[model samples]
Structures are given as structure tokens and as C-alpha cells.
Target: MKLAMKYIILYVNDFDKTMNFYKEILGLPVKMQHDTYVEFDTGATTLSINTRESIKEIIGLEMPASSVASQTFELGFVVEDVVATIEMLRGLDVPIYKEPVTKPWGQTVAYVTDPDGHYIEICSAME
Candidate 1:
């Protein structure tokens, strides 16, 4: 059997804020959208955002609270300049989880959390 992942859906409390972070801040074009749901054009795998309340009501899910301190999952994005990207987000009043640090493998990486506390890694392309 074979399987392929198509979307990474983030169930969020503040749908508008999370939507704006990915759309206005990260600059991901919206692939589709509704009052409670949105999908971004993120390469082959779509980045989706939906309201937590909606999902819970629909699927009867009891999702745990969002957390940045506790380990969970991370979303990665490659940018041209890690430092510049971090600075840009910082200027917009986005909370900076970690400053940019060049890895021993030659890739510069940094971390930040979204409105729902999902960790995102901003990095330079692997060299």
C-alpha cells in the first residue's frame, strides 16, 4: 500500500488571526476559503486552517489545547535569508521564539509560533 499526504490542517481558536498570519504574513495564497475553513496554496501539500469549535462540533473531537512549550509538531519553510525573514516577522510584532542560528550543516534556522501556538521553523535551503 502507498499513501501520500495532501494537507496539514491546523485547527485554531482564532480563525481570522491564524488565517491572516499565513495569508498576510507568510504570504501564502488562498487556495480555497469559507467562514470556518481555509486552504493555502503550499506546494503539493496544502496548508489548511479551520476553526476548532467547528471541527469539534462536526467530528465530536476533543482536541487538546495549543502549546508551544510542550513538544508537538513543526512546520518548516525555506526562505532566502533566515535573518531577514525573522526580522520582518519581528517588525510585524510577531513573537520570536528563537533567534536565527546557522546550523553546523550550513543551514540557517529559526523558530516562531503562530497565533495557535504551532511552531514554525524558518530556514535557509540546505547547502
Candidate 2:
């Protein structure tokens, strides 16, 4: 058997706000969109945003509560300059979870939160 990962779907409460954040803030190109679903082209993998109600209707079960306080998962992005990315995120008024810092492992990383409180780590390889 063979399997290939394709999409990471984030079930959101406010569909429009979440969709707009990915589209306007992160500047991801929209691959497809409908009343309840939106997909963004992020190179090899696609990032999809769906409404909780939509999932509930499809699965015929109540969706569990989603919380950012759990800190269980995050989306990471590799950039050329972590500091510059942090500065740009600050200018956009994005919530900063941690300031840019170089780790002992030779990576400069900074953390930020999206509108839905999902952590986004911006990092660059240390020279």
C-alpha cells in the first residue's frame, strides 16, 4: 500500500474570518473555494479551511471543541530571514507568541499565532 499526504484541513468556527486570514494575511493563493470550504495552494501540500458545521453535517456527529490553549499542534514555515519575517508579522499586527531567537541547534525561530490562535513558527537555518 502507498499513501501520499495532500491536505491539512483546519475546522474553523468563523469561516469567512479564517479564510480571509489565510488569503489576505498569509498571502496564500486560493486553489478553490465554496460556501463552506476553501483550499489554498501551498506548494506540495494544500491547506484547506472548513467550517465545523460542514464537518458535522458530513460526519453526522458533533465536532469536538477546538482550542488553541492546548498548544498541541502548529504550522511551520521556513523563511530566509526569521527576524525580517517577525518584523513583517509585527507590522501586520499578528500576535507574537515569541520573539526571534537563535537556538543552540543553529536555527533562528520565532512564533506567532493566527486569528484562530494556531501557532505559526517562522524559522531560518543559522549561518
Candidate 3:
């Protein structure tokens, strides 16, 4: 059997801010929207955001209040120019987690923190 990615859901504190970030800031089209959930069109997979309170109610399990350790995963997005993207995001007051750097593999990559504390990787597409 093969697994296919359907959605990457983020449980966030400010649902509205995250929704608008992916919509207007990142330029992702909205596929669907609900009271506490919003899904964005991100090529093959869907990027979804939901309020932490809603997730707790749906799962009926105790969730961690916040993460105090290092980040485990990053939401990566390939763009035309890494420097341009970083500069634009910086103008909008987005937190830059890492400055643009060229990897030995010949790709440029940078990291920015999302509204909900998730790292968003802005990078050059593989050649």
C-alpha cells in the first residue's frame, strides 16, 4: 500500500491570523473555510489551520499548552527568489528564523516563523 498526503493541519492559537497569513501573506488560495478551520490550496497537499481549543474538543484529549523545545518539523515552500521573499516578509514584520544561505548543493534556503510559532522554509526550487 502507498500513502498519499491529504492534509497538514496546524493547531494554532490565533486561527484568524494564521489563516490570513497563508492566504494573503503567502498567497495561498482558500479551498475551504469553517468557523474554526481553514484549508489552503498548496499544490498536491492541503494546508489546514484550526484553533487549539477546537482540536482539543474534537480529540477529547489533553494537548500540550505550548512547546518549549526545539522545532521538529518545518513547513517548506519553494519560491522563485529566496532573498526577495525574505525581504518582503521582513517588511511585514514576520520573524526571520534564519537568514538566506546557499547550501553546497546549490540551493538557497531561509526560515521564517509563522504566526503560530511554526517555522516556514522559504527556499529556491531544486534544479
Candidate 4:
């Protein structure tokens, strides 16, 4: 038997907006995209955005109602300039869940939620 993990897919209501949020605002590279899907190369993992209805159809399950916990996954990405990145994202109208703070892990980090409500943490290792 073979067990391996693949990509994480986020069911977004608006695919384009979500894609733009990740690509333009978050600066993740878009590896592939179509009318219904967008895939990003997130270093160690691939992240995807697809329509909610399409995702439900694929999984043969009904979509859940939006809630504080519905979109609970926290996607972390390495960043060089935490403060500057937070400011740039703020300028683009992205919600800042938390501002940059030094963590015990020796990283300066900040948090933001995507259009679909998934938390994204940006961090830089302390020198």
C-alpha cells in the first residue's frame, strides 16, 4: 500500500476573486487556472481554488453553511518582510486578522483571511 498526501483544495464561492486574492495580494504563484479552477504552487504543497458547488458535486456531499469554523484551515507561507507584506495586503483591502508579532518559534508573523475565509499566516524567520 502507498500513502502519500497531495494538495489541499479550498471550495470558494468566487473562484476568480479568491485566485486574485492569493495571487495578486498574497503573491503566491499561480501554476494553473481555468474558468472553474486555480492551482497554486505553495512550496511544500499545492493549493487549489474551485467553485463550492463543483467541489460538493465531486465529493457527493452538500456544501456546509458559512461559519466562523467552516473555513478553518490555516495556510502558512514564508515571507521576507513581514511588516511590508502586511501593509501591502492591507492596501489591497485584505482583512488583517492579526498584525505582525514575534513568535516563540523565532519568526515575525501576521495573519489574514482569504475571501473564502481561510486563515493565511505570513512569517519570516528571525536572523
Best candidate according to TM-score: 3
Predicted structure with the largest lDDT when compared to the true one: 1
Give the candidate order by descending TM-score: 3, 1, 2, 4
lDDT to native, each model = 0.88, 0.84, 0.87, 0.82
- Model 2 lDDT tens row, 94-125: 88999999899999999998767888899995
Any idea what lDDT model 4 has? 0.82
lDDT of 3 by residue, 1-127 (tens): 9999899988887777887788888889999988888889999999999887888898876556664313778899999999999999999888899999999999999999888779889999987
> Candidate 2, which segments miss by more than 4 Å at Cα?
65-69, 125-127
Pairs with steric clashes in candidate 4: none
Task: Give the lowest summed-lDDT range of ten residues in model 3.
Answer: 61-70
Cα error, candidate 4, residue 27 (Å): 2.4
The residue pairs found clashing in candidate 3 are: none
Error of 2 at 79 (Å): 1.4
Give the lowest summed-lDDT range of ten residues in model 4: 64-73
